[model samples]
Target: MSELHHYLELNDPVAMVWRKGNSQDPFTDRNDLLPVINGIITLLEIPSSQHKVHIDGMVEINQELYNQTSALLPEQFLVNYANGSIQFHPQHEGATFSCKYKGKGLILYPASRIYAMVRRHPDVVKTLQEIIDEAHTKLNDTHLAMDQVEQAIREAHDASAKASMAADWASQAAANATDAAHNASHAVDSTKLLFKPAVSDMKELLRTHLNPQVGWTVQTYKDGIRYRYDGKDWVPIDIFGKNIQLVNEHTDGLMSSSEHSKLKSIPLETKERVIVFCLPSYLFQGVQNIVARFPFKGEIVGIKAICGVPGDTDSEIIIEKSMNMKDWHNIMSRPVQLDAFSHYDDGQAVVDRATVYAGDCFRLHVVKQGLNIQNVTVEMIIKI
Candidate 1:
């Protein structure tokens, strides 16, 4: 029988050859290139040479070397298999070969396949590292921004609190200034009352001529009149009831006379024209009658009186003043019947009286008895 030649390819670009004869002598050239055949053939057994002499090479693949070389290649050359195994194609200058390996199997794969599969691991690891680094940087920036926002919030709160406190302090200061201004205004008004030019002169005159006790100072001065009193002066402090003339130094001698007799007798006249100043109608309860007499003689030709009523209604009173004891002059007379005492209800009526006189030593009378009297005020004005 003749012999046959066979070839086997290996992953390292090497081929192995062997010779085979009939079945009775299968490996006829077993000693020829047996080692080289083992380096290429992946199977252990030879092919059948029953009727023909077959020469085939047994390829022995060095799985370790294939894996080491394949690991050096890039992942682009490696393919993923459906069975959880990897297949790699090794392309060298114009030649290419593919080899497959199971993940759990001990079978060796081609060096190119192993190199391509292993090379992808490093790229994946590097990509994952880059992703992780980017994530870390982004997280750090976010944290920094959050810190800045928190700081800004704290500062804003502090500034708002300070502004609120400042506003409160300013409000308090304004209120204090307003209160101080009010108090100062009141003090100025009081000082003006104490140093009024006319009232001060009148006080000095009273102090010199009247022999009044000390502490009899004027407290209120208005409308050409002064209200004065000592600590113990309780005689009502009325200028009219005292009967002494503040100008002519004469007393009203008819003050003790009965109303009927005074009504019938002619009152003494004043030579110098006298002026009687009273408070406003609202403050008329504090009004005082001041009599100033003069020396002269003339006929009683005129009689006039002024009466003031505050917030008067139709039911108010009208009183008459008389120059001659027999004749009455209607100063505030009305046709309708009026309440003669309406002024007493509000305490807001003032009566000022003057008479054209015919003689010196004028007499004046101002009387009030339980807010009612025959005459509230009587004054005589005489010619000079």
Candidate 2:
């Protein structure tokens, strides 16, 4: 008979039992038997409230009872089952255990090691769907944000184009306005020159107004002299005598001279009004030439002239007005031939002279004329 003792190793998940004669040495050098120990612990049944079991010193059991208990052992722990007998041998020094199977080897492992041998399983569809859904949502948000950004850029480009066009139009409009203003100013200047009088009018006035038959002669008065014209008609003395001095003094004098010499002397104090005439038929249409001069400002009113040649079918009358005295533009008239003395009265159809400011200057343009012909003479009547 033998006594048995049981111990469990918590860190190794193994249980061991020893059987010895009374006073036998304690078991040792049996660590390699841990797997076999765990297998035995799994095969035995322990009695307790929560399946706890303990090993106590026991002498022996009946042979029949030991054999039945041995039958309950796991397959790896049974040896010589067909013989209906069990034998134990010590494999390590001071160990009281033997291999349960004599020729075959069995190794037991911890529960954790068994679990490690199993493969892991996961829900593939669930994970893939979550990933896909998140991607779809992010893509949709990105597309929307990109659309907003593009729209803003388009709006900004449109606004810039509109502003550029407006600026171009404004610049063009300013240029046109400037050109129109310049043209208007030129038109006004042309009108002014057409009405100015020249130096020739003063000489003509002196010739017409002063006569010898009238008293107050230029030969009798040099500086200042009074002359008797009639009973109560004694005129006062002046530079341009009452009437006769003007005819005598200006008739033979040099108009361009700056000094008063005997041959070119003129009364320095007196001024006279000049008159001239222009006939549209003989002057403007017949000889095709007209030129006159005046002293100050005046207007052309009428023309009177005598004809030298007989009236012909080609004769015509054309009156042209001009802002510049050199270039005449058309005003009014009809076609006629002159064979005798004739008159052309323009009436209110006149070109009036304008006053010039001190520092300002003006110019006139003869834009167009009534008739186009070769030769003509125009006698103009001007009032100053």
Candidate 3:
């Protein structure tokens, strides 16, 4: 029998082959029949003129979207799909531009020609069938791989979500620990005030005591006076008595009422302290405001201004003191003037203002600024 008859007898495999009238020629073209697409927009290398040139595949000129007539229409251009060549319209001669399209057109053979070849070599049909089956198996494997990748991605997302939740819990735990520590510290401070030791005086108390905590107290046996260490000094406790005599520190003798009154009028020099604020040279434009609080009962004894660098001009630094942050009055009789590279101090003079109690607000207003000054330090002395 003929080879064609023998092939046909083997379960009619020829009928299972591609039924398309024009099948791509695997020998002369790529294994895949589909054209390779140029997905990105790119410039056309060849001139889009009347000359017929092989573009390698179908040409999709972007100009078509703008002017539809300049497309693959029969009246506008001539195309040979079999050879992948195109001849542009005469009107678009020698035009160079960007174009995007698929490359390498499929080389198709007529079904009649393939049938004739299949009759001479029936094995060719079987080989083609085997290739199709192998391709199907590979496509199935690819689908399985894609599914595994998707599952891995889902697992990674769940792990990330758990990590974020763990981080949130850790942050909350840290905040709670911080609050507990703060409460413990406050409790320790309150306990220190209630549980202080009864020592003779500050000298003997500090000899053994390492931590001289604030608000702790000490008593002197000789004077029968109880003094509290108010952070800076061992202040005498305010005790109301019917008959109290003022005694000197060196000589424990009774003091006259006049001497006691004078002592009350002016605070001791050792109890004087300073509060300093430095103003940069750049802030010499307008009025600068400063607000401070006195922690102890005191009086503003003095104001001093010191310049670090000398300038060409002098500065009349007008210092005004305010108790309520609204109404203000000059602390000096006139504006304090500081020469170049000099210091100005309003001597320890008490104004008509009353003594400032604890928690009282003191504000200073600097009205004028020195020109080209390098550094300015303003110091206010308080007598407690």
Candidate 4:
């Protein structure tokens, strides 16, 4: 039994052990420690930008100050999972903020007692050895079978290559035959005597004096309309008779489902609302508030910030909106970056945050102005 225990320990996947067993029972006497561990930590800081600070290993956070601890509300702060940092909303700056949270760690797995029990039984060890020997013999036979299959695959691949070459030759022959037939169909008969006259030459000959075939066509220069002879009379041709069915702008067209879908995708509504903000003689980087009231209820489609003259340095501006002159929120996902060469920055309107009701009072915040940038214009487009 002692020799079997030594063999099991020596043949183990890893030989090193961090924490050995504290138990007296032989089955639970030995246990190798795993690397998995977890713990909690506390951090304190005063933030300046957006009133946010970084906390390491903080899976969760609870504010602790002056012998009082309370869980921070999700709305009061925003968690940045990518960098493991927390950004608190407006205010909460210049104050001591402490966060207590558990650190991230690998999942804990208890030591295996089954391996110890198996190592103790000699009969089980003998059965396992027999099974392992059988598996080794079967593995050798599988290797031999795999070699045979590889040889067969190589022969089959060679045959498939020959077949592919044959198929290509057949396809080329068929294409050549089709081209010959197309050329034959389009070839004009030189045996038939026909007169080729221009519109000016045909104008001298009257309709009664002209000899026309059933499928003969003539174009008039006066109205630019084509006339086709129908054996009895010459009739004006309707080019779009089979293709278009015009009723109204929305319900027009005799088209397929896919064609109708494509037509609906085209934006026909040309009505656009533009709100312009002008920065007159502004040289410093600061926020500009433009107070305005929405006249009609509509959805915001897009926003464009245009500058007449781009400054020497790159400029960036953030647009925010506030209802009732308080509680401002960013309308733009990110700050619009401007440069000397480019004077315009376009942004797509976020549907949920951009909707405005009629008679709603709102203001635009054009913050973070660049150096020496003047005559700045911000355009907000609304879709009715």
**C-alpha lDDT values of all predictions:** 0.36, 0.36, 0.52, 0.50
lDDT of 2 by residue, 46-156 (tens): 111111111111111334654776633211122232232322222222323322111111123343323221234652333333455678999999999999999999999
The segments of candidate 4 whose C-alpha lies over 4 angstroms from its true place after superposition are 1-270, 346-352
Residues forming the 10-long window of minimal summed lDDT in candidate 3: 26-35
Q: Report how far residue 235 has shifted in candidate 1, in Å.
A: 59
Tens-place lDDT digits, model 1, residues 251-270: 33323235445555765753
Could you give candidate 4's per-residue lDDT for residues 1-384 as a string of tens digits? 111112233333222212211233211111121121121111221122232332211122334431263334322444443233454433434333444222221112223222222455354433444556678999999999999999999999999999899899999999999999877754532122232242522354244337776556665543344566666775666332343454444563444556677777998766777666665554334345466677787877766777777766666766666565556667666666666556776453343467877765545554544545667776667776
Runs off by more than 4 Å, candidate 3: 1-152, 155-270, 341-355
Sort the predicted structures by lDDT, highest score first: 3, 4, 1, 2
lDDT of 3 at 132: 60
* Residue-level lDDT for 298 in candidate 1: 44
Scored by lDDT, model 1 comes in at 0.36
Task: Please provide, for model 3 over 1-384, each residue's C-alpha lDDT reduced to its tens digit, 9 standing for 90 to 100.
Answer: 101112243443233121122333211211112222331212222222332322221233444352655444322334343344445544444443222232322333323223312444335443454556678999999999999999999999999999899899999999999999999987765445432656654577668566666778666554456666656666777432324455654433356556756677884457787777776543243345466666788886776777677545566665555557666666555554666555553343334554667766654444544445556777777898
True-structure RMSD, every candidate: 56.1, 61.0, 31.4, 21.7
Q: After superposition, how far is residue 174 of candidate 1 from its true place, in Å?
A: 53
C-alpha-based local distance difference test score of model 4: 0.50
TM-score of every prediction relative to native? 0.15, 0.19, 0.29, 0.28
Q: How displaced is residue 92 in candidate 3, in Å?
A: 58
Best by lDDT: 3
Better of 1 and 4 by lDDT: 4
